[model samples]
Target: MVALKSGLKIRKLAATLLLLGSSCIALELHTDPAVAVDPVDAVCSNRMTLSVTGNLKVPYCSNKILDQPDLSVQRAVIVIHGTSRNADDYYQYMEDAAKKAGKLDGTIILAPQFLREEDIESRNPGNDVLFWTNDGWKEGDSSLSTSSNPRPAQVSSYDVVNFMMAKLANRNVFPNLQTIVIAGHSAGGQFTNRFAAGSQEPIVESTVIPMRYIVANPSSYLYMDEKRRVAGTVDKFAIPTAQEKSNCPNYNEYKYGLEKLNSYMQNIGVNKIRSQYAQRQVVYLLGEQDTDPNADSLDKDCPAMLQGKQRFERGTIFYNYLQQYYGSTIQGNHTKVTVPGVAHSGRDMFNSDQGIQQIFGSSPNHHLNHPTQPTYPTSTSNS
Candidate 1:
């Protein structure tokens, strides 16, 4: 007979077996199996929605997060989904990693959905939901103009993060929380990088809790200057000649360089934003196998080409360029982590040994690459 753990209710069915030569007694028993459930699914069977204001319901998941009985959550991991707008999928990956590292009990996992107009149209979330223009949300821009529906208030995608952080910062909501990590890969990575630069949220300043940003394998980066890496200087930072800038004048525009700023970042001076960004904790996670110069969704614009032919190269160039621009006086607390054998993938990048350490704070040295390797941008890959 197998003894079950206390508090476990079980039912047993038994049968007797007979032998040919002699009477024999055998016991056949049926017992209920212990079913391990995912916290995300257990707590939120479906996506949970947060109303930003009157009519806009932003969908998200908080994963038992800070509401567990007798459990004090101390850290949170906010994972931003990629262009696919697959928040649910991204949440699962983060949840799995947290569970693997035994941090699931104390860590909150949040994944916010930024839907496109097409998604809104298909779902017809009524007038109560908010959706952004195609890729407008990525730039932290306001909702798109719709001919049928009068613009539903002017809320930027970044505002969603600000709103969530405000809730988390509330002492009553997450009293035990001491740290928050904002991480994203691919397009989400681009958002995390830019958001960290100009975010006006005071949550980062909360004396009680510190926040960290993880920008992983973004296709493009927002350069702080008009200068770009010369094509020939493959491994080093070399600015384009005067003639190159002359040929591509608009190359320094927004999203590429700090030239024409968007409405969200226009008022904030570039120097001010750079200064703020320099003082924060940032990690640049690059994919080592993302070297396809002509990969799908590689941002083949002339501006992106100026950075590098591939994602891995561009990330390396950008990190080095920042160090040079900021100089030695106030160097930012930025660390580079490399994910080997992955390319343009969010799941693999976040679940790797390196991802576990950086996001959940376990086995910290497992992610560090060799010192001789280009340590500026730690290489990661997605397969």
Candidate 2:
């Protein structure tokens, strides 16, 4: 009996050492400037293998291992990248935000990269790594399979997030973890908004870990209904006219209004999705000066134009629609925050005092103060 107890104690000591070593590796990755360069066809060094049926893996930059138990970590922030697929840059942005908020040591920052076929071609990450089409990842579409690099199984980007949350929910892994924040900007904003609507919220709910979503300057949003802001009006919403419908037939389709959902979203079904999203804690972070309708990266598709003119307008209108649609259901659950003097930049959006508060829940250097109304500036040419 004494020998068996000694053996168990030895195993416990080894596990503790493993956790400590993992934490140190994560800290080194965050502080190392050489590994945190601007992302241009770059993949993060750490790859998180999903606990799914197949041998699937996704590249990510994190300040802590998902499976390791770390008592110091109280919060987890998953920052998604935009159309550029620059997860490293987004990771650094959130890391800097956490530092500024004085929550660096207690926060686990993760930036998962959703690679494309072209990105795979440039880097040639192994066949087990999943690659999506150009816009597939943005809309929760399945990973692609090509003749050269056959994917073992088709996985949705949302499924990857579900798996991550499941890992974090493990009591043995994150006993002290209290919150999870999923944030994104631009195209990443689109992903966050849609994913929040369709994600398996019950996974974390069972563990009582509260989750919040921070959606920054996205070109469009996932409208829960067919109603849209009437043209030439700021707050008025109506179903598209017959002529408008004729011109833009698919305006209410998948990404825009849920007429057709991707495989992941379809499984969740529209009724459950709308109900869950209305009850979620979300903050729409918009930039005051992002008013240029002709900005190079703005989505000019008919469905997007149906939302609003530009990023700022689109966000404001959508929030207003949510208020009118959900009524008392979303009183304290949802909100809109606008960063003054900022325009279409992820760094500016995530580092502002308001952004820091939303990302870290609270900031030591600043107090949380959200403007009651969004202030828009005159149109200016800015990306």
Candidate 3:
């Protein structure tokens, strides 16, 4: 009996030690090692994973404490990644911009990774990460169902945005957060623009914090109306030409226009979305020299061609188009900055003087009487 009791005591001690070790590991995971030591180190370390659904968890990198955000942080920037789904690179770009603006310590930067189906299949991760089909998430498509991980209740990519925003809006989670900026480039730019326009829950209504959007060099924009931007015109919108119609019959459908929206957009009407977008603060960052018509990711589809031959032209045309249609509704809410020599590069665009200023330099007033002037910086960017 004595030997048996001693054996049981030893086993109990071993179990206690294991639990204590696990607790330490959990504590370590919550606290980023570099944050309190150095701002640059803080910005680059401690990427986190968030559970968005019962079966889905998304990976995100952040500068703030994942478990307990510093109350001193007043500004938060969520940087979305492009087609490559290289969110880590995008996060670094935001960190670099924050460093330039000298807002590195006071800002909380987040970059969420939206993986592809293939990415999961190849890795065969036991913990499921939220994923969308190739380019499907760009349009805020619902998460794809797979054999390894089935989502009976589908969640859209925009839903992830809603989730994160809601979390930030909570007073308990982010007591000092005053501003939140959503910015993206390339395919991510496409996501940000559309998400700004079509999100069912307007950020203003949902959160007390001021929210802004930065759309940089997207291949296309979702027109509020059936009209398409005519190339070479400063402000003109019309139906697609004969060739365009013949080639891209579904040009005005769903993502291109609001014809057949996905599950996430089904509840809201297009006009409501347009009105909400017009009232929100948005900045268009265009690369003045991003005029490459033949770039591989330039959205060469027929629907995209209706916008412009190149990204720079399309951005200008869209700005004019929005001003014409929305009239004064979007007057104080929209501004466009043209970056002199950057093109289709998130690193270059966000690191530029204008990029740093727009993103991290200053915070816009919640109520704007007039739109801020376009930033024209002569300094060169080394991205």
Candidate 4:
């Protein structure tokens, strides 16, 4: 009996010890390393992807804070690439400028690819699916190139401009918007000139909206007439008084694509600028050296820009007409900027510090809510 009690007591003590041991144990779980996170670092990695021309490209610009723009920044400057289709490179250059100016977010810089033939085309990209057709300004997925079969609902290249204007008009789209600038180079410049003169869209005529254009370094300029200089020194008479805006709805060659399609002009129910189109704000930017004897040489027979001492010199003649005789008569202002020592390149004075202020430069002027506050300085840019 004594042995049995002793054994029972011993067993009881052992059980108690085991229970206490189990209760005192502390458990710790190990987690995956990835579970340890930092919020700031995650935001730093966040990036936006922009796809243009059916190809995915990363604007991939620096995340540095952009410019703190005022109401003046309510503008969209759309740039069109030349025959080289070097939109990407041109975009990068503008991006760098924007970054420097700190207006990266304030301004919307859009560059489109105007694809041309292999003879006129070069090493840059030209194969992406087009988002727009140069045809009469349709909106939405552009129809396949005529060279392409069974077109995909033909949309006009002008459609993009229309779409952009709508986006700007909606405060929801750009709350801080005030002006819109359409800019292009080389062939792109050609598009700007013709479209400004004969846009199939309505925004071209709306005076309430501040719309502007910058045509840079185009080989061919839409001449007001066949006027040249008197021995490259003084202004002679304008050739035939060939008014640009007066002649409209004639595709010239754009009709090949614009024929029987949606146009900004057609949508507004007018056939000519005199009937419907308003005098648009236009600026011409040129390289002082792009005066190739064949620079403005589209054809020799009919000349808006005749054989002159310098290409720039000839361009100055057009600028003078639009400003002195033309724009002033209609109360519209035209800007002319000459690039010193630069030839056929994208970096012109207009896109520079002196030029940005020249182009978009405005101080805190009085006379609120009027065009007077942001008066543009008089420029002598001829070509």
lDDT of 4 by residue, 1-383 (tens): 00011123555466556646774421110111011111111011112222233322111122221122344454456666544444555555566666666676667665544332231122222233332332221121232444532222333455444544554455544556666666766556666765665543343222344666677765444433234344445466443334531342231222212233233434433245433223555677777677655433221222323424444654576566445335455334456777767666665634565446534544211111112111111111111
**In candidate 3, what are the lDDT values of residues 35-96, reduced to their tens digit?**
11101111122333344335456667777664575688888898998776766678888999
Task: Give the clashing pairs for model 2.
Answer: none
Output the number of the TM-score-best candidate. Answer: 2
lDDT winner between candidates 2 and 4: 2
What order do you get sorting by lDDT, best first?
Answer: 2, 3, 1, 4
Candidate 4 residue spans exceeding 4 A from truth: 1-73, 116-128, 131-144, 147-149, 200-209, 224-234, 238-271, 274-278, 294-311, 323-327, 363-383
Q: After superposition, how far is residue 136 of candidate 4 from its true place, in Å?
A: 11
| lDDT digits (tens) for residues 1-383 of candidate 1 | 00112221221111111222233311111111111111111112233334433545666655763333323777778889777666777888899999888888888888877766655554554555556654566667765546765444556677667666666666666767767788999888888988888765442322556778889998788887766776767445555677777777777777677777776666567887777777767788888898887565566667777888888988888887777777754333777788999888888999988888888783121111111211010111110
Specify the highest-lDDT model's number. Answer: 2
Q: Which runs of model 3 end up more than 4 angstroms from their true locations?
A: 1-55, 200-207, 241-243, 367-383
lDDT of each: 0.66, 0.78, 0.71, 0.43
Per-candidate TM-scores read 0.77, 0.83, 0.79, 0.56
> Deviation in angstroms for 374 in model 1?
38
Worst 10 residues of 2 by lDDT: 374-383
Q: Sorted by TM-score, highest first, which candidate order results?
A: 2, 3, 1, 4
* Segments of candidate 2 deviating more than 4 angstroms: 1-40, 203-207, 362-383
| Error of model 1, residue 232, in angstroms | 1.6
Candidate 1, residue 36: the lDDT equals: 15
